[model samples]
Target: MNGKQDLSKVSVLLVEDEAFMRRLIQRMLEDLGVGEIVLAQDGGEAVQYILNNSYAFTLILLDLEMPRVNGFEVLKYLRSAPDVGNHDLPVVILTGHAEKERVVQAVQYGIHGYLVKPVSKADLISKINRAMTKPPIDASHLK
Candidate 1:
């Protein structure tokens, strides 16, 4: 448990429709000592949740392809507002993809970072820590 724990210190918003995938990511974040976890069944819910509770989340792990409101749409929604107070929230796309062009496109869209699906708890923890603590490409640079 080196450099780990204090679950009451971190909060996460998990946006995934797949119940199993959501649970898995939740468990992984929890194991990393996230204090609170917000579960959004779809992109619509995720957006609303962020609007209503943006201040609570230290990070958001989003999935690219989802029903109703895909991750791209959600990101667009967030960017369009610019008032959610989460414009800088660490959002890491967790998906089962590794296409270079797709990744670049995502980066162009202002994603804080990304991790392939089935991401290990350890990797999640590491990425989570880095995303929240590091200086992501300045918000001003996002197109």
Candidate 2:
């Protein structure tokens, strides 16, 4: 059923303010055999990391609530980057937020997937794998 998410070469970027959450997600991604994981504390760092780095990451796990910059803003920025919106870069909004508005807003911002907080290793790993193997959205829909 196309469940074989070939993620052997996937690189990940995790943006979260909480240290524990960040570490937990990192470990979970590692367990999934995802190659290369980087952490960013805020939207600014996330933006800088993507800009400074030459290779585009396979996925980005963004937290909704962050200081200085938020997930929505970061998603918007990433989509606006040259050759990025159409690129097969998956971004998942993983946070504690459950509001319908927040979820809708995230979807509108062009992320690949969304997962609620307190996520277990199984859930986290599965979501990331799905993002890697699944096809990305159209570029026109991103803006």
Name the candidate that leads on lDDT: 1
- What TM-score does each of the candidates earn? 0.86, 0.83
Task: Give all candidates' CA lDDT scores.
Answer: 0.79, 0.77
Off by more than 4 A, model 1: 1-7, 137-143
lDDT of 2 at 12: 85
In model 2, the clashing pairs are none
Question: How many residue pairs clash in each candidate at the backbone level?
Answer: 0, 0
Q: Positional deviation of 67 in candidate 1, in angstroms?
A: 1.0
Model 2 spans with C-alpha error above 4 angstroms = 1-6, 82-88, 135-143
The predictions' CA RMSDs to the true structure, in order, are 3.4, 3.9
Model 1 residue 56 distance off true place after TM-score fit, in angstroms:
1.8
